[model samples]
Structure formats: structure tokens, C-alpha cells
Target: MSRPPRHDEATLLDAAVRLAAAGGPAAVTMSAVARESGAPNGSVYHRFPQRSALLAELWLRTLGEFHDACLPVFAEHAEPHLAAGAAARQVVAWSRAHRERAVVLLHGVEAFGRAEWPAAQLRRERQAARRVRQAVTGLAERLGAETPLDLDRVSLAVVGLPLAVVRRHLHAGTPLPGHAEELAERGAIDLLRGGGS
Candidate 1:
């Protein structure tokens, strides 16, 4: 009997991510991933039934990676407000470091309406968003101030900020540098300290 070839789901995912990062999410398809990974199309489909599934997995994995990168920043600071600032800084830094993946993640959100993602995934996305919004509001309150922070509005804005930053860089096909976190932190601090007008 012949032994079957070993296949790594992670190895296949990395290829999909690289393709999406290079030429936008459109570049990622089962065929493209199989070609990139030097794997058979049957092998790829055996793992992810459709391109959407692969893309969804890639999105979550990349987003989770970026979130993990900020965990230490959150842990290191005792003050909730300062920690938020620090988190923002680290997030922006991560966005800069992972520009291509960041763009893929950002554009994924916009393409979402068109993609018609799985309902379960959309709900999970909403829930994860709620957690982040709660954290921000909690930080503001803990810092001895109240925030008129509408989680819906702020969460959407905060999530989209990285996209704006990333698009400016990618579309220009050049370096675009700015400290968005500083602006966000200062704005946040001012609002929490003096309530939003």
C-alpha cells in the first residue's frame, strides 16, 4: 500500500494569506491556494469546501494574531486609560508591520456585505466587537470619568481607522507615516475627561 502525502492546514492557510495580501482578497481562491501551496485542488477542497471558508479562516487568524500582539500592552499597564493608549499605539504599530495582511483584514469588512458571509460568522464578529467596545467603555469609566461612548458608533469607527491608515499607504504604493494612536488616545482622553460635546 502507498502512503498518502502529508498535508498541513496551516501551510495551506499561509499560502492563501500570502495570495490575499499580495493582490487583495480576490487573489485567494482554491485554485490559487493550491497552486501557491503546491498542493492538489482536491487536497485544498478537502480542508475548506469553498473559497469563503478559507478566506474567513484567514481573516479570523490574522485578526486574532494582531489582537494577541496587543495583549501584552494591555497587561503591562495598570491604569485602564493609559493601557488603552498603549493598546492603540501597539495596534497602529502592528498595522504598520503587517500592512498587507492588515489591508486584507480591513477590506474584508467592506467586502462583507457583498460576500454574504456565514450568519454564524457575522454574529460572532458582532459579539467580538461588543467585547472590544465594552473594554473601551470600561477603561474610560475606570479612569474616573464617564463616557457618552456609543459602542456601536465608536466600535465601527475604531475598527475602520486601521483601514484608512492602511489604504493611504497601499494605494499610494509608498510609505505613509502618522501617529493615529496619539490622536485617538488624546481624543478619547479629552472626551472621557470632559464628556463628549
Candidate 2:
């Protein structure tokens, strides 16, 4: 059998994550990933083929991982408000658990060259977005949302509010505070209950 390659796709991707986390999407070139992973330049090219491909894979993987962590929390609670709070708190908790990936996500898909992504990558991005929209819509409906504004409130409570908390700390390169989960949970519940008057 032929000898196994020294560097794998996952290894290269992890290095890309580090580079993106440290210096944003502009840092994650194929050459940079190779250098960061100690892999041959050809190895990265072997997996990614182009800089846009590498960026797309890195962004999709990070986004998929985040959705995996937060979406399940929505299904775990029977009560809509409880589910919303849990989902919000999960956003902060996942960020705390995966700091580098969190930072990568904070850079957003546009920063990852989404406009240049291959069709397959773009489809995957849409699928992930659909999943989030479905979950948020379901929760909002369960919470008696009747108007577009009501849906917006639920979206803010479960997604926007928690992300704001994460963004504040991560953008500053500061660790999330110890009470982040509680703060996220409480803020989400308050938003859901307060309503727009």
C-alpha cells in the first residue's frame, strides 16, 4: 500500500480556523494554511484546489458545528419561552466552548468569500440558513407570533441577543464572563415576554 499522506483535510482546516480566528478571513490563504499546519503546499491544494474552496469549507464547517450545538437546544424544551432561553444560552455556551471557531463565525460568510463560492458550497450555505429559519419560525409560531414583528422579536431573542453578547466579548478578544449563560438566558426570556408595545 502507498504511504499515507502526512497531513489530512481536517488538520489543514483546523489550521485555517486558527488563521481566520487570529486575523479574519484575509489570513486563511492556501499557503498560510500549509504553513500553519506544517503541511506541504501541495497537500492543501490537493484538498482545497483554490483559496475560495478552502474558505468555503472552513466557513461551512464552523457554521454547521454551531447550528448542531444550538438547534438541538430548541427541541429540548416543551415550553416555547424555555426553548428560546435555552437556545440563546447555548449560543453563548458554544462560543465559550469553541472560542476559535466562534471567532471564525463572527467574521461572517461574506468575509469568507461567499460570493465566489462554488454552487455546491452555496447550496450548503442555503441549507444551513434554512435550518435556522425553520427553527426560529417554529419557535415563534409556538410562542403565538401573529405578525412579522412578532417573528422578529423571537429571532432577536433567540439569535440576535445572544450573538450580541458573544460578539461584544469576542470582538474585544476578551473571555466571556462567568455569568454569560445566565445573562443570555435571562435576556432572551425578557425579550420574548416584554413584547413590542
Candidate 3:
């Protein structure tokens, strides 16, 4: 007799990410994920009754990984401005390295709606956004500018700068331009210190 199958939440989530990244969110289904994971469909439903729950868990895991990826920037630089620039460049580098996953995350549609899952996903997303924004705003504040800069605008610039650059490159099916990292770093710096330049 075959040994009892062993599958865990992590395995399901990994399969989900792979499926979604390869074929977009619409391709991720209970049977498809189970087949990819070598588990039964009931296992998928057991862990995540709806696809949205699976998507939410997958996205949360992605954010955790992204945050860990950026953590090194802060470790290397204690200064807020330098750290912020390093963080932006690092994120861009990660996107280049993980193009499929990055693209899936950057532009994919959310197949699952708020009504489909626990409210915790929404709360976690908002908290994560706030933390990232706070990091950017703190960097801007440390620029020693004569006048106080607009925190919200600078925060949006800081967050959007890397994404915009990566989005264009991925959409074009091209590698990041030679100056992409440099531009991302400089853009972050300018947004933080250059008075909205």
C-alpha cells in the first residue's frame, strides 16, 4: 500500500504561487494546485476553502519574503537616507532576479474579494503598507532639509519609484536598463532630500 500522503499549508501555498505566477490568478484552481502539489483537492480546500484565502496567504508570504530581502539594507546602513536608497535598489534587484514572481505580484489581478476571506488579510496588508511607507517617510525626514517636506507625497514617490521602473522593464520583456538601479537609487534620494525634484 502507498504511504499516506503528507502535505502542509506551506506546500499548498508554494504551489499556488507557482501556478499564479505561471498562468495568472485565474489559472489557480483547487484541482490544479492539488495536482501541482501532488496532494488531494480536499487538502487544498481544507487549508483554504476559497481561492481568495489561498491568494491572501500567498501574498502575505510574498510580502514577508520581500521585507526580509530589504532588511539587509537597513543592517548595512544605519543612516535613514542611505538605507532608504539601498532598500529601493535592493528591491529592484530582487524584482529582476525574480521576474515572474515580481510580475505576478506587481500587476496580477486579485481573484479573491474581501467578502471571500477573513478580514485579517486586509488588516495585514494595510499594516504592511504602513510600515513600508513609514520607512520611506523617515528617510525623507532625515535629509536635513530647510523646510518640512510633504510626507505623503514623498512616501508615494519612494514606494512608486522602484515599482514604476520595474513595471516598465517587465512590461517590455527587457532587462532593467543599465541605469535602472542608479536611477532608482537617485530617484529615492531626490524624493527624500531634493524637495520634490
Candidate 1 residue pairs in clash (backbone atoms < 3 Å): none
Reference-based TM-score of each model = 0.73, 0.96, 0.79
Question: Residue 153 of model 3: what lDDT?
Answer: 45
Evaluation by lDDT, superior candidate among 1 and 3: 3
- Say which candidate scores most in TM-score: 2
**Candidate 2, residues 132-169: lDDT per residue as tens digits?**
99999999888999999999999999999999998989
Task: Note each model's CA RMSD in angstroms.
Answer: 4.1, 1.5, 3.6
Off by over 4 Å in 2: 1-4
lDDT, candidate 1, 71-107, per-residue tens: 4565567865556556656666777787766666667
Flag the better candidate by lDDT, 1 or 2. 2
Q: Which is better, 2 or 3, measured by TM-score? A: 2
Q: Write the per-residue lDDT of candidate 3 for residues 61-146, one digit (tens) a residue.
A: 77777776774574477676666678778878888877766766775335535455578888887787787766655555664433
Q: What TM-score should be assigned to candidate 3?
A: 0.79
Which residue window of length 10 is worst by lDDT in model 1? 151-160
Instruction: Kindly indicate the candidate among 1 and 2 with the higher TM-score.
Output: 2
Ranking by TM-score: 2, 3, 1
User: Clashes in candidate 2: how many?
Assistant: 0
